[model samples]
Target: MVPRRIICCTDFSYNSEPARELAVDYAKAFGARLTLVHVIDSSLFPTYVDWLGDEIDQILARTKEAAETKLQEIANKCGDLSDIKTCCEIGSPAEKIVGVANDEAADLIVVGTHGHTGVKHLVMGSIARSVLRTAHRPVLIVEASPLG
Candidate 1:
């Protein structure tokens, strides 16, 4: 089946760079429309009520701006594909990514995994794994680091 649409979720981490590249290549190969998505995990931030008196708004604004810039850079590096789109969302990363994929009717979802094990894995659950488990569409999980 032809993948007419693809959703790529990125955290802009060094580990995720390869997944971004892979998504671009896949999009090119399949002649698919690509949507580059970045989700801001708001849970990491203090509650809105708690931050009302602080610089939280400013921080959020700055972070969004930076994410947009980085998303543009990623799109540019992916190639001159007119069909490419960029989106910045706020919520749980994995949930937002899946939500976008569903909302956009993506045929495939691409994500990067650090492949952490042991205590590390327990602490930081695998977003890629969660997506793979819950996504209705096909999911591609790229290991952040290369394997020997």
Candidate 2:
């Protein structure tokens, strides 16, 4: 089915670039509205530090701003799409992405994978894998091109 809305997730990493591009292509092909999303990993901060609340907030605010700016830059490069949206959220990347997809009633979820495996995969969980497993809607995963 032709999607009415598509959600593309990015960490602003090289691994996710292909997926972003593919998402833009799909959105244009289907005349769908594309929503580009970035999630600020809440795990990076210390939640138990009460004294750091203000500091954390300041950091998070800056991070969110930067993420939004980057998303806008990417959206600007998506050619002539009429309906492109940018979302910056704070939480687990995979969870937030799935939540956004559900909340937006997105017809499709597009995400990129770092193709991590072995110990690295064990240590740093795969967001794309989690989204694929948990998302209620259809998901399209783009694997990063292998490094030379």
Candidate 3:
């Protein structure tokens, strides 16, 4: 198959790092353009606003700054790949990921699965699962283990 665009969604969790690695490897093997995306949950901003009061802007700024830093770190770790692109977006994680995949015309959506089960799955929900269900393109769900 011809190498096409691949979208990798990460939350910067320890578990998600393996997914990032796998996405990089797949991109390298296929010579595909890799797009690394991180979504900042919008729900988090309001919670901070209530607590931080007047400092909400500063908090949001810092949050974005940190996210950018982390995104750059991930991009750096992926090494020099001309085909790689990195992006940070704000909104629902699953929606933003799927939206980016669609907007970028990605051939596949790659994401990490934390393997949440039972009540934990119900409570935390699974971005991977949502993407798998909603994405128009093929989805690659990488487990948090093995880093492959």
lDDT of each: 0.85, 0.90, 0.83
State the lDDT of candidate 1 residue by residue for 29-97, as single tens digits. 888999999988888888757737657768788998999999988888876676899999887888889
For model 3 the local lDDT of residue 88 reads 88
TM-score of each: 0.89, 0.94, 0.86
- Give the candidate number with the greatest lDDT: 2
Query: Candidate 3 lDDT, tens digit per residue, 1-148?
Result: 5548999988888878877888888888888999999998877777644767768677667887899898888888897676888888878888999999989999988898877779877644477878888897899887775342
Clashes in each model (backbone N, CA, C under 3 Å)?
A: 0, 0, 0
Specify the highest-TM-score model's number.
Answer: 2
RMSD values for the candidates in order, in angstroms, are 2.2, 1.4, 2.6
Superposition error at 126 for model 3 (Å): 2.1
Using TM-score, rank the candidates from best to worst. 2, 1, 3
Candidate 2: count the clashes.
Answer: 0
The all-Cα superposition gives candidate 2 an RMSD in Å to the true structure of 1.4
